[model samples]
Target: MKIMSVFGTRPEAIKMCPLIKELQSHTEITSVVCITGQHREMLKEVLETFTIKPDYDLNIMKKEQDLFDITLNILDKIKAILIKEKPDLVLVHGDTSTTFSTALACFYLNIPIGHIEAGLRTYNMTSPFPEEFNRQAVGLVANYHFAPTEQAKKTLLAEGKDPKSIFVTGNTAIDALKTTINPNYTHPILEWAGSSRIIMITAHRRENIGQPMEHMFHAIKRIVEEHPDIKCIYPIHMNPKVKTLATTILGENDRIKLIPPMNVIDFHNLLNKSYLILTDSGGIQEEAPSLGKPVLVMRDTTERPEGIEAGTLKLTGTTEEEIYKQFKLLLTDKVAYNQMSHATNPYGDGFASKKIIEALLQNKKD
Candidate 1:
């Protein structure tokens, strides 16, 4: 079976890279990767780490590309590829515009779609903005729903999706850790961290811009000011609003290093070295738990509630006081820190890629 795997962005690439490798190893499955180039430099870094050169690169990234630009560019570009390849199954990951647009194009062509990391929901579509809608919309057309957890499967079933089509394959994000993380890895950032604790921060959610973001930064700034034994590394997002807010609030601090986003290998190694994580992103909620790093999620709501249930994450709303309170507790309370850091990752056991491939192959057989 010829399976065309479609993804863009660093998060999609990181999760899908392991599955792509698994697909290529099987003689019975022909795997093709198509990158939307939604993110140029960051995406390239991830691809190089996995040694994955895409069969097709739709260079869709532009100066301040908005949601409309991404959707249309992918729709226009991916259509041509789909016409030429016409794979037996088209696989899409998570809830990026690439995933949604690619799946829509496939549906238009009557091509089968297999959605990876499917059935994540906040129900409040505006919370995660287009992402909540993107995943739910893709769920409507996907032939195979590869949910990350049992909770995800239940969500799909509750939404009236066919149970037979839904498969709980765990999360591919966990599988990625096995490949990207290196125990012996060393970088200048690690050296600069010295004997002090490293607090890795990644906050780039669309909804949390403006005042909400200011609140998060203020919390971080307060923590840094109070705690001299800690250093914070924030890989600022490409968004100008985020950058400006971060620079105005966090840039002045010598202890907080505002660097460009790190690649999968470097990011994974950094996560391994991190004493704690504060984020408002989705994938990190899954990734940090596997590394035994306690995460304080800087968001009001999250679709990935499995981490909360497993005791690896806590939801600190986008408020200055709330974030500061949670941040300080983790630093001060050893028992609380250890409990969260040591929780079992409900996401996967590093076999998600194999299971997903097996499901695909079995679908072909059936």
Candidate 2:
């Protein structure tokens, strides 16, 4: 079986690389990797961490690229590769423009598509910007739906996806944690944090860019000011607007350190050492729970409702007042903090990649 895996961003690479490694181990499968280079530097870090070198790199990223540029460029470039390789199956991960475009190209060529981390839905098109739309659109045409949870499977069933086509493989994000997290890892940033309680922050969602971002920063500023022992380490995103806004509001504080993005290995270890987390990123919601870190999701809604139900995540919407309340509650109330930290991680065990590959092999046999 010729199975080609396609991914673009850092988050997608983190989840997909483990599955790619598993694919390479099987003599029956010819695994091909194609990267869109949508996230450029950040994506490279993850690929390096997993020791994966793509067979084809689209290199479509450009300065200030919009949704139109990403979607159109991927369609234009990947079509030729699909025709040349003509794999038996093309696999795509999550809801980036790369996933949607690759799936569409496979659809045009009549090649079967297997969607990883499938059936996630917020049903709100504008909240996560293009992501919600991208995932739903991919679901419409995917030949196999590898949902990470029972809730995701139910969502697919309700949406009329065929029962036989869906498989409840645990999330590959959990699979990634197995390889990345190191107990002996040390960094200069951890030294700087010292005995202070660490609060790791990652806020770069498109919908939270302007006023909502400012509000988030202000809340963090207030928290750092009130608690002298708490230190915040924000590994800022590559977006210039996010950097400028974050610098303007949360900068100049002694307790808050705004730094560049870290590699997945370092980031996972940091999460392991952190007191708590604050973010709008979806992958982190699943990843943090495994490290026993309580996460406050800075969004109005989330597709990963399993985390919330499992008591590991709190959906504190984008507002200064509400965010401040939740942040304070998590910090000051040890009972609340212990309750969240001790909650079971609902993502998966480390065998998700194995299960995903088995599903593909079984389908081929049938």
Candidate 3:
């Protein structure tokens, strides 16, 4: 059977790359990759790093893009590719607009779609904004749901998704670690961290752009001032709005190195090197725990509650005092640090790609 793997954006590529490699290795499956290049440069870097040459490229990037442009552009461009290739199944990852739009296009063509990292829900639609809506919409149209954890499976079942169609395959993001993070890996960022405890920070969520992001930055700035031994490396996202906000709060801070977004290998390596992580990004919550890196989630709510329950994560919300208190405690208290870092990873054993492909092939036979 022919399976078309579609993805866009950096996080989607990092998570989906492992599954794509697995599909290609399987003798029974014909794996075809198609990139809706919403993130043109970053997507290409990931594809090259994974050595995945796309069967089709829907280069849908524009200089100044809005949500409507991305949705409509992918719809028009991918429809033709789906019609021409006509794969037996379309595999989409996570909750990006690309994943939802691709699934919608496949649904329009009467094709079966499989959703990877499915069934993650915060219940509140407005928290994650478009992501919550996108994933929910895909859940409706998807023929197969590859949930990352038991919690994710429960979520799908609670939403009344068919149990038989849902497979509790662990997250593909964990699988990506096997390919990307190497023992011999070296980078300028890693070198800068030196012998000091590296606190990796990534705060660029849409909901946390203005006051919330400022609150997070201020907390970090205070941490830097108080703890001279600790160093921070923030791989700032590409959004200009986030840049302006970050600049305002963290400008000319020597201890806090704010760099551009790193590629998949670099990112995985940094995550590996870091002592702890602080972020509002959804994917990191799943991926970080597997590396034994405790993630202090800077959000009010999270879809990945399994991590929080398992002690691999802590939700400190967006308030400055809350963030500062939690961060300070983690640094000063060894018990709190060890408890969080040593917790069992609720995500996967880095073999999630194998499980996902096996499920797909088994279904085709059935």
Instruction: Tell me which residue pairs clash in candidate 3.
Output: none
lDDT of 2 by residue, 54-133 (tens): 99999999999999999999999999999999899999999999999999888888999999999899999997989999
Which tens-of-lDDT digit does each residue in 87-198 have in candidate 1? 9999999999899999999999999999999999999988898899999999999999999999999999999999999999999999999888889999999899999999
- Judged by lDDT against the true structure, how good is candidate 2? 0.95
- The per-model lDDT (C-alpha) reads 0.93, 0.95, 0.90
* Model 3 per-residue lDDT at 364: 74
Q: Which wins on lDDT, candidate 1 or candidate 3?
A: 1
Candidate that beats the other on lDDT, 2 or 3, i.e. the better one: 2
Candidate 3 global lDDT: 0.90
State residue 33's C-alpha deviation in candidate 2, in Å.
0.4
lDDT of 2 at 133: 94
Say which candidate scores most in TM-score: 2
- When sorted by TM-score, best at the front, the candidate numbers are 2, 1, 3
Per model, state how many residue pairs clash. Answer: 0, 0, 0
RMSD of each: 0.8, 0.6, 1.0
Candidate 3 per-residue lDDT, tens place, 1-366, comes to 999999989889989998888888878888889999989888888988999999888899988787799999999999988988889999998888899899999999999999999999887787787788899999999999999999899989998999999999888888888888898888877677788899999988788888899999999999989998889988888889998888888877888888888888888888898889999999899888988898999999998999999999999999999999999999999999999999999898888889988888788789
Candidate topping lDDT: 2
TM values, all candidates: 0.99, 0.99, 0.98
Supply the TM-score for candidate 1: 0.99
Clashes of 1: 0
